[model samples]
Target: MKFILGLGKILTIAFWGVVLFNQLLPQPVPFNLLINAVGVTVLGLHILEVLFFNASLRGRSHRWFDRLQILLTGIFHVMSIPRQPQLPRNG
Candidate 1:
């Protein structure tokens, strides 16, 4: 799973790079729209992952950076941060 997430991060960065390069060309490319659409979807998923799974980091002093890392690396960053242990519930 970590490997897959790492692959996703690389793909996301490459996709955005292609999108930006397409934008700078003299003529709009036929596949640019499709690439942009996929890029947006991937970006949205990353943002949502940070919002939901990584909410605990929001209270930290370097939260902005944490959020950014979550957005870029997804669960890979989440895995690196130490999580609090869950307390037992009494009946």
Candidate 2:
């Protein structure tokens, strides 16, 4: 699972790189708007992910950097954060 998440982070970073490079190329890339739209949509969703996972992010040593990684890598980053232990309910 860790390996998968690591691979996902690498792929996501590559996608971001392509999206950025596509903007700079003088020649029109095929599916240019599609790529741009997907990039924007993913970024927006990642921002929401940051908000949704706000509680998990509060106490970490590198909170801001973690949030930035969450912004870039989305769920791939989120999955890496250690989950808080659940308390037992005494009925």
Candidate 3:
């Protein structure tokens, strides 16, 4: 599952890079609208993941960077982040 997620992140980043490059071209490409629409859809999905499934970043000091990682790398990055284990309190 982790491997699959990582692969997904890689593909997503590559796709966004292509879309951005296409947008920078002087003349609009034939598939510009389709690529941009897919890019927006992917961005929305990542934002939703950050909002709902972001347990790995709950108590971090540098949350902004973590969130950016989530945006760039998807849920695989979130899964790779190590959470501090909580110790039980002794009364």
Candidate 4:
């Protein structure tokens, strides 16, 4: 699982690299438009993930760094974070 998540992070970074690099091409290809659209869409989804998981990030160390990673890697970064164990309540 850890390896898979690491692989995912690498792939995500590579994808973003492609998206940014695609924008700099001298002669535009038809697929460039499609790539741009997909890149923007994925960025939106990553932002949504950060919003939805904001509560979980409270009190965590390096919270800002985690948020950045979440933006870059999306669910892959989220899955890699270890969950805090729940404390039992004395009812």
Candidate achieving the largest TM-score: 4
Q: What's each prediction's TM-score? A: 0.64, 0.88, 0.69, 0.91
Ranking by lDDT: 4, 2, 3, 1
Task: Please give the RMSD of candidate 2 to the true structure.
Answer: 1.8
Better by lDDT, candidate 3 or 1: 3
Give the CA lDDT, 0 to 100, for residue 18 in model 1. 78
Evaluate all candidate structures by whole-model CA lDDT and list the values in order. Answer: 0.74, 0.91, 0.78, 0.93
Candidate 3: segments with Cα more than 4 A from true spot: 1-8, 26-30, 83-91
Per model, how many backbone clashes are there?
Answer: 0, 0, 0, 0
Q: Write the per-residue lDDT of candidate 2 for residues 1-91, one digit (tens) a residue.
A: 9999999999999999998987887236557888888999999999999999988887789999999999999999999898878789999
Cα lDDT tens digits for candidate 4, 1-91 = 9999999999999999989888787227778888899899999999999999988998699899999999999999999999988899998
Instruction: Name the TM-score of candidate 2.
Output: 0.88
Q: Tell me the deviation in Å of residue 69 in model 2.
A: 0.3
Full candidate order by TM-score, most accurate first: 4, 2, 3, 1
Give the clash count for model 4: 0
Candidate 4 stretches with Cα past 4 Å from truth are: none
RMSD to true structure for each model, in Å = 3.1, 1.8, 3.5, 1.5
- Residue 29, candidate 1: C-alpha displacement in angstroms: 3.5
In terms of lDDT, the poorest run of 10 residues in model 3 is 25-34
For candidate 3, the clash count comes to: 0
Q: Give a tens-digit lDDT track for model 1, residues 28-59.
A: 55587777776678779888988797668855
